[model samples]
Structures are given as C-alpha cells and as structure tokens.
Target: MLKGKKIVITGASSGLGLMTAMKLVQQGARVAITGRNESKLQAAVQSVPHAGRLSTYVLDVTDAEAAAKTLDRIWREMDGVDVLVNNAGFGYFERFIDAPLEHFEQMMDTNYMGVVRCTKAVLPQMLRRGSGQIVNIASIAGKLGTPKSTGYSASKHALLGFTNALRQEMRGTGIIVSAVNPGPFESPFFQTADPGGTYVSSVQSLMMKPERVADAVVKAIVKRKAEIDLPGWAALGVKLYHLFPRLSDRIAGGMLNKK
Candidate 1:
C-alpha cells in the first residue's frame, strides 16, 4: 500500500527514525529524511537498500524558519508528502534541580515546537489534497512521567496532546494523525539520556529492539491506528497508572528511579 507514496521523516540520521525511513524505502515508498547533520544524513542515504528512492535534507527542526523552508523544498522535490513523521527529538535525564533550566527549554523547543512547525508546513497541502498522515514519535514517558524525565516527558506530553486534538480535527478528512509511544528501545538515544548506563542497565530486560519498533511503526501507518505503545506489558503500566495514580506511583517508585 505504501508503494510510490512520498514520506518525510525528521531525525533520520540514526535510531528509530532512520530505521523507519529505511523500512519504508524497502516497502517501495519514496522517502525524504532530514537531520541536523549533513554528514550523517549522507551516511544514512548510503545505508538504504534503494538509494534512488531515498533523499536526505539537512535540517534542525528547532529552527522554525529554516524548517518551513526546508519542508517546503522537500514537498516540491518529492512531488508531495503523503506522510510525515515528526521524529526529531532528544532526551537528557537529570533531576529537576540538578539539570539546568536551559535543558528543559531546549527539549521543549525541539520536541514540541518542532512538531508544530513541521505540521503547520505540511497541513495546508494535506488539507488541499484531503488525504495525508502525520505520525508523531512520542514516548511512553509522555503517558507516565517517570523520575529524571521531567523535561522530556513534558515535551512528549504536549506532543501527545496536540496529536490527540489534531486527530479529532482530521476526522472524516481522509487524514490520519497518530502517535507512536514506545518504551525505552535499544537506540543511540540513551547515549545522552543515560550516559552512565545506569538506567539502561536497570531496564536491560525491558529494552526493546529498534527493528521491532520500526515494524510496529509501519504497521500503524498502514492500519491508520490512532496510537501505539510498544511492549504490551509496559502499556499495562500506563493503564494501571491512569486507574490508580497514587497507588501506581507508590508501587512503581523504585522502578521509576533507575535513572
């Protein structure tokens, strides 16, 4: 179903975004990937099985002006974007007190405002065509705010809120707005989020494979699923947290403090 469809993904230099782009290319979709590093984007292009079907753009989603121009260029270059994946973001894990306020500001800028800017750039064309899909790469942290993820969680929470509302607005418009909320996966994201490897070690047993999560992302796109939470077991915790907030927090306190 994805054959010949034009898709754009941000942060495709590495991790889940890169994997998803490659997977889509493999499925015969034309993909345009963007990243802050030009060299890394070039490297990602080389890694794709069908290089001709993949294009790269150097972009920093945090820059609203540049993002608008770059996304517009991509839309024209690719003929049009049938799907857009808002996957550009990073996380840093430090206590609210120890972490500088600047860290949170950066996170909010890149994770929340970035999505807004890119979505705005594409929504007009999508509305004109009456069909499109916007997939926001949120996190499990968005649903259940854990220790040491205050900024990251807040940004993702905002993304989730925006996605939910956008999905409501897009109903009956042949446009799909979805959020992929995944648990900690084996990706370079932890390099910054858990430099000491403490949290990764603590969640070693629960760490998911990027390949599996990439498959789930493609499935969500094809199925037009509203939301996806990786590792069914972890999603159970989110449900429990919603049902019993105080009790869930108390019971999960130790586990949540791995960082």
Candidate 2:
C-alpha cells in the first residue's frame, strides 16, 4: 500500500525509525529520513539496499527554524509528503528528586515540542493536499507512570494528548493522525535512558525486538489505525490499569519500578 508514496521519518539514523524506513522502502515507498547526526544519517542511507528510494536530512527537531527549513526542502524534493512519522526522541531515566531540571526540559523539548514543530511545518502542505497520515511514536510509559521515568513518561504523555486531540480536530479533513505506543524494546534507547545498564538487565526478557515494533509501524501506516500498542500482553496490562487503577497499583506497583 506504500508503493510510490512519499514519506518522512524523523530520527531515522537507527532503532525504530531506521527499521521503519527500511520496511517502507521495501514496500516501494520513497522515504526521506532525518536525524541530528549527519554521519549517522548518511550511514543509514548506505545501509539500505534500495538507496534510490531514500533521502537523508540532518535535523535536530529541537530547533524550530531548522525543522521548518528542512521540511520545506523535503517537500520540494519529494514533491509532497504523504506520510510523516515523528520518531525522534530520547529518554533519560532518573529519579524525579535526583534528576537535574535540564533533563526534564530536554525531554519536553524533544519528545513533545519537537513533534509540534514538525507537525506545524507539514500540516499546511497536507491541508493543501487534503490527505495525509501522521504517525507519532509514543510509549506505554505515557499511559502508566513508572519510577525513574518521571520526565520521559510526562513528555510522552503530553505527546499522546496532542496526538489524540489533533486526530479529532482533523476529522473529515482527510488526514489521519495515529499514535504507536510500544513497550520497552531492545535498542540503543536504553544505553542513554539507562546508562548504568541496570534497567535493561532487569527487563531483558520483556524487551521486544526493534524489528517487531517497526513492523507494527508499517502496519499502522498501511491500515491507518488510530493507535497501536506493542506486545499484546503489555497492552492488555495497560488496559487493565485503566479499568482498575487502584487495583493495578496494588497488584503491579513493585514490578513498575525496575529502573
């Protein structure tokens, strides 16, 4: 279904973004990938066998001006973007009291405001065309708070709020806004999010593969699903938490503090 479609994905240097770009390109989509590191962006383009189907841009989504300019270039180069995947974000897991104030600011800027800047830049074109799809890479952490993820969870929560509201506001406008909420995955995310390596070891068995999450992203885009939660068991846990908040905290409180 992605054949010949023009797509843009942020943070495509590695992990979920890169994997999803590969999947889309394999399905014959023309994808433009952006990342903060130029070397990594070029490397990602080289890693793909279908280089012709990919374009690379160096973008730090935190900079609103740079995001606007880079997206304008993408529109010019790709003719127009049919889909946009906001996948650029990082997590730093630290206790709320011990964490530095800057950590929270950085998370909010990249995980929440970054999406805002990119969406603002692209929405005009999508509106002009009257059809588009926006996929926001969120997390189950947003749904249920966990210890040591105060800032990260808050940022993702804000993102989910924006995504949900935007989907409603865009109703009947021919634009699809969807959110992908994945649980912990095996990726470099933990290298920074858990620099001490404690959390990864604690949840090694539960870490889903990046490829699996990427596959779900592709499916969400193709199916235009409103939302996707990875690893069915984890998703069910989130559902149960909503259904029985007090009971959930009592039953699973200890497990949520692996970090």
Which candidate's lDDT is highest? 2
lDDT of 2: 0.95
Residue-level lDDT tens digits of model 1 in 1-259: 9999899999989999999998999999999999999999998888889889999999999898998999999999888999999999999999998999999999999999999999999999999999999999999999999889999999999999999999999999989999999998999999988999999999999899999899988988889889999889889999999999999888888878888
Top candidate (TM-score): 2
Compose the digit string of candidate 2's lDDT tens values, residues 1-259.
8899999999889989999999999999999999999999888888997889999999999999999999999999899999999999999999899999999999999999999999999999999999999999999999989999999999999999999999999999999999999999998888899989999999999989899999999989999999999889989999999999999999999998899
The predictions' CA RMSDs to the true structure, in order, are: 0.8, 0.7
TM values, all candidates: 0.98, 0.99
Local accuracy by lDDT, each model: 0.93, 0.95
Candidate 1: lDDT of 201? 96
User: Which pairs of residues clash in candidate 1, taking residues 3 or more apart in a chain or in different chains?
Assistant: none
TM-score: model 1 vs. ground truth:
0.98
CA lDDT, candidate 2, residue 9:
98
